[model samples]
Target: MTDRFAAFRALHHGDRPLLLPNAWDHASAAALAARGHPAIGTTSLGVAAAAGLPDGEAATRAETLHLARRLRGLPALLTVDVEAGFSDEPAEVAALAAELAGLGVVGINIEDGRPDGSLAPPALTAAAVAAVKDTTPEIFVNARTDAWWLGVADPLGQALERARLYRAAGADGIFAPGVSDSDTIGVLVAGLDAPLNVLHRPGGPTVAELGRLGVARISTGSLLFRAALGAALATADALRAADPAPGAAYPEPPSYVEVQRLSAPPGAG
Candidate 1:
C-alpha cells in the first residue's frame, strides 16, 4: 500500500497550495477522485446536514466513521473534518483519529470551536493533537482554530498562539477560518511555522491571490455540498418555468466541482 499519509503531507509542501475539495459521501468522493483530485477532504457540515444531524457538535462520530469506511477504497487520498474530534476528551479524539488512520485516511482536520458558538480551550485542541500524533505518528493533523470565526478579539494573535501550541504538540498544519483580508492572511502565513490553511469563501480572494500570500492549503469546506443543494433547486425552478419540462444541452459552465478544480491553487514559487 502507498504511504498516503506521507504523500498527503507532501502535497502541502508543493510549490502551490493544495486545493482540497470537501465531499459529503462515497459518490462525491469517488467523483472527485475520478476528476483527478489528488487529495480530498470530508466536510463535517455536509456529512451532518445530509443526515439530518447537527454539525459542530459531537453528533456525527458514527456518521463520519461510516463515511471514512466507505471512502477507504477511494482512489484519492482523504482527510476528514472531525469537528473537534467529536469529543471534548483528548483520549476519545485521539482514539477517533487512530481509527480513521487505520481506515486508510491520510489526514484529519480537528477544530477548536464548540457547538454553542464559542471556542474551546486551546489546550484541548493541543492535547488532542499531541495524543493523535502519539498514536498514529503519521496522520497529517491539521489543527484548526476558530478564533476568527468565533469573533474573538485579536484573532490573529490567538490563532498564532494556538497554532504554536498545536505545532509543538505535533500538528502538521494550521487552519484559521474566517480571516478574510489579504494583509491579515499574509501576516498569518508569515507568523505560522506549519502550512497555513484558509477556507475558500465565494467571491473572496481567488486561489492565485491566496497562493501569492504564501498559503499552503485551501479547503472548500461545505461549499460544494451547499452549491449542489442550490443547483438541485435551480434545476427544479427551470423545470417549473417550462411546459413539458423541455431539456436542452446545457454545457455552458463546467460541473460545479469542476469549476473549482480548474482554478487549481497557484504556486507561491
Candidate 2:
C-alpha cells in the first residue's frame, strides 16, 4: 500500500473525479476498502446518528474523534467530515483539525451548513478553513457550500463567493452539495481554482457527465449510509409483511462477532 495521505491527495486530480464513498463506521469503511476504494471518508450524519446525537449541531466532536482514531488504522486513506468544524471559533476548529492530522487523517470536509438548515457566515467559515490549513498545511481541506441544499436562490453566487474565500484561505478543494444541474455545475467547475467536489445523487448526472463538466471529486455524502439504513428497514418490513417469508435474507448481515472483530476500537480487544 502507498502512503495513504499522499496517495489520497494525488487521487484528487486524476482525469476522472474521485468517487468518494463516505462511511459511518470502521466496518463500513473497511468493507468499502476491501472492495477497492482508494480512500474513505466519514459521514457526519452517520457518525452522529449512530451515537444518538443530532447532526450539524456540533454535538459529535467526541464521537468524531473516537471514530477517527478507530479508522486511522484502516487499509485506505481516511478523510473526516467535521460538520461546520464543530464550532464558530477558528482556533477551536483548527485545533480539531490538528488533532485529526496527528491521528493520521489526511483530509477533512468542513461544511457551512448550520443546525437551523442555514449557512454559516462565509467569512467565519473561511477563517476556519484558513486556521485549519495553517495548523496542518498537508491536510486536505474541502470547503463545503450548502447553498442549494438550503434553497438559497443565489446559489451560484454564494458558492462562488465562498469558494473564492476558502481558496484564499488555503482550502485544497470546494464541495458544493445539492448542486447537480449541468449549467450550475459547469459554471462552478469553471470558476473555482480548487478541485470541485459535488454530491452524487441518484437522479444526478453520471460520473462521466461530471467529469466532462470538469468536476474533480464526487462525494456520496451520507447518501450511502442513509441508503444502507433504508435498505435494512425495507428488508425487515418485507419479511414482517410476507405471508411465509420474504427473500430478504440480507446476506446474513456479517455477525456481531465479526463486527466486534472489525471494530475493536483503539484498544481493549
Candidate 3:
C-alpha cells in the first residue's frame, strides 16, 4: 500500500506532466488502464449526473464511494473526486478519506468551491485538508480552488492565497481549474510548493504547452465524460439520418463482448 501510494505520488514529478483521464465508471476506468495510463481520477459531474443527482452540492457521496469500490481492482492507481469532501465537517471528510484509503484509493481531489457561487473560507478548507491528512497520511489530497471557475475578482491572487493555505494544510497537490491563461498558470506552477495541477481545456494550452510551463499534473475533469455523452448523441443522430443499406459503413463502435470484458478481473473465468 505504501509502495502504491509512493508510485502515485511519483507520477506528479516526471519530466512531463501526468495526464490524468477522469473516469465515471468501471468500464471507463478499465478502458483507460488498458490504454496504459498510470493513474485515473473520477469526475464529480459525471458521477453525479449518472446517479441522477446534482453536482457540487455534496449529493453523490454514496455514488462516488460505490464507483471507487468498483474501480479498486483496476491496474492503474485510483484517485476520487469527493467534491468539497461532501460535507462541511472536517472529521466526516476524514472518515470518508479513511474509507477510500482502505478500498485501495491512493488519492482524492477535494475542492473549496460551494454550490452557491461562493468560496469556502480558506481556513475552513484548510482544516478539511488537515483532517484528511491527519487521519490518512498515505492518501494524496489534491486541494482544488475555484477562483477562476467562479470568476472571482483578482482570481490570481485568490488562487495563490488558497494554494498557499492548502499547501500549509498538507495538500500533496494544488488544482486550479478554469485557469487557462499561460501567465497565470506559470505563476501558480512557479509559486506553489506542491505539484501544480491545471484543468485541460480544448481551446486553451495543449498538454505539451502546459508541460513546458511546468505543470505537474493535467486533469481532464469531466471533459471525457462530456465527450462520451456528446458522441453517443451524435451516433444516434447519424444512425437516424442514414439510409437503410445492407452494408452501410459507419464508425465502428466497441462491441458488447468487448465492453463486457472491461468488467472482468484479470485471470477471471
Question: lDDT for every model?
Answer: 0.88, 0.88, 0.93
| lDDT by residue for model 1 (7-101), tens | 89899999888999999987778778878999999999999999999998889999999999988876789999999888878888899999998
| Ordered list by TM-score, greatest first | 3, 2, 1
- Candidate 2 regions off by >4 Å? 1-3, 243-245, 248-269
Model 3 agreement with the true structure over 1-269: per-residue lDDT tens digits: 49999999999999999999999988999999989999999999999999999999999999999999899889999999999999999999999999999999999999999999999999999999999999999999999999999999999999999999999999999999999989888888889999999999999999999999999999999999998998787777766878465134445667899899999987687
In the range 153-261, model 2's lDDT, one tens digit per residue, is 7989998998999899999999998998999999998898989999999988999999999998998989989989987887878777782645435545677886666
Cα displacement (angstroms), candidate 3, residue 183, comes to 1.1
Question: Which regions of candidate 1 fall more than 4 Å away from where they truly are?
Answer: 243-269
Q: Which 10-residue span in candidate 1 carries the lowest summed lDDT?
A: 260-269
Candidate number with greatest lDDT: 3
RMSD of 3: 1.9
Which of the two, 1 or 2, has more TM-score?
Answer: 2
Q: Tell me model 3's lDDT, rounded to 2 decimals.
A: 0.93
**Please, what is the TM-score per model?**
0.90, 0.92, 0.96
